[model samples]
Target: EEKIPGVYGIDTRALTKLLREKGSLLGKITFEGGEDIEFHDPNQENLIAKVSTKEIVEYGSGDKTVVLVDCGTKYNIIRCLLRLGVKVVFVPWDYDFTQMEYDGLFISNGPGSPEFAEITVEHIRKAMEIGKPICGICMGNQLLCKAAGAKVYKLKYGHRSHNQPVRLVGTEKCYITSQNHGFAVDNSTIPSEWEPHFINMNDGTNEGIRHKTKPFFSAQFHPEASSGPKDTEFIFEEFVNLL
Candidate 1:
């Protein structure tokens, strides 16, 4: 046998089968003669601070101004908003923008658990108090639910793929969506003012939420799918209309 001290082998089929049957899991790799490593859960700390912008960043110069909370936001989200002719103001996840004049507040997708993003939750709470149009994607979805007095929990495997199917609640319309997250909002915990807007067709998990009397809404998937189907891109237009 070849004496390779740091060789590794991965059985893709086996891993896929395991994930399909058991959902996503945490594991670690090790070498025979190397130091043992431990699996560290990324959701245990404040991940938003690590991925959010350090300073305020602006994009476009349109009439509608949107204060986007940058919690590890995806670039396509900003690109999509800019394409709609909206001025985008990217702020750190922990920064306060409630006092700023903006037509809407957008929370961007990011890594980690929403509970760890306590500051962002507080900011969203403040935005609700102001009653402006608010929208969120991915982790933004969970944060919005939490701010609205709902609870969130980690999924068994989580939805993390393109082509995930979501259906509009109380309707037969369904759309393929791009998604990436490890947690979901507990639908049963949502307050009366908010209701499930969309649900995953495959797993029946909450995919989106909307407020009954407020201009607040969020999706657990990316409407601005960068390299995926554009089936739900109209959601952005609807949000812009709300503004």
Candidate 2:
């Protein structure tokens, strides 16, 4: 707001905005492509740019679900998962899964090559060793594919927007989805232990996978989409059912 300036960021937990009603503060906050968050900060010069760009624990915990997170997908993605009766925990890319504990795990949406996730892969291997219900999306999908003995190749320019055509593996039905990623799972290297469930109709890329014998599975698109099509919203129901 021109009349007021506030703190803004891609992390939309609403803490900075709520703190703005003090009137003595000037805050101009905006979460990645989201609305502008403005208020007032009198003491500082240009308060909007100085509102501590650091990440202030955007995640919370609950008894219902647990999730692994990255820099992409933003906080809105987590909100959707929470609304579905899931309590999520943000696991970084390098934490040893064997050290920590949680319930069903959700590999979150993110950008970058899946190979960049050495820690996630290690923890995933451990989860599979014990048979956990895991779900991966976007980069999460690529990580699962690679962790289960598949290879990931960087796409030139990558798929960074919404509206992708995905087909159910057996049904041959198409579901348009919101996608954002720069890499894809190489089907040729997918291990027999992981069963590919969905395929991208446009590029023939691996869009989803499930373990043949484990309760874990994943999709390459966002079912928790902020405002995208709801064609795959049932995936959330299926995930809770699997849990």
In candidate 1, what residue range of length 10 has the lowest lDDT sum? Answer: 1-10
Model 1, residue 15: distance off in Å is 5.5
Per-residue CA lDDT of model 2 for 31-91, tens digit only, reads 6788766755343242212221223233554556565544354566667667777666665
Candidate number achieving the greatest TM-score relative to the actual structure: 1
lDDT of 1: 0.90
- The models' CA-based lDDT, in order, is 0.90, 0.67
For candidate 1, the C-alpha RMSD (Å) to the true structure equals 3.1
Please give, for residues 1-243, the per-residue lDDT of candidate 1 as tens digits: 786555347788898999889988887667679888876888677888888899999999999999999989889999889989999999999899998999999999999888888888998998999999999898899899999999998899888788899999989999999888889989999999999999999999999899988889999998989878889888788888989
The positional error of residue 32 in candidate 2, measured at the CA in angstroms, is: 30
Candidate 2, residue 103: how far the Cα is off, in Å:
1.8
TM-score, structure 2 vs. true = 0.70
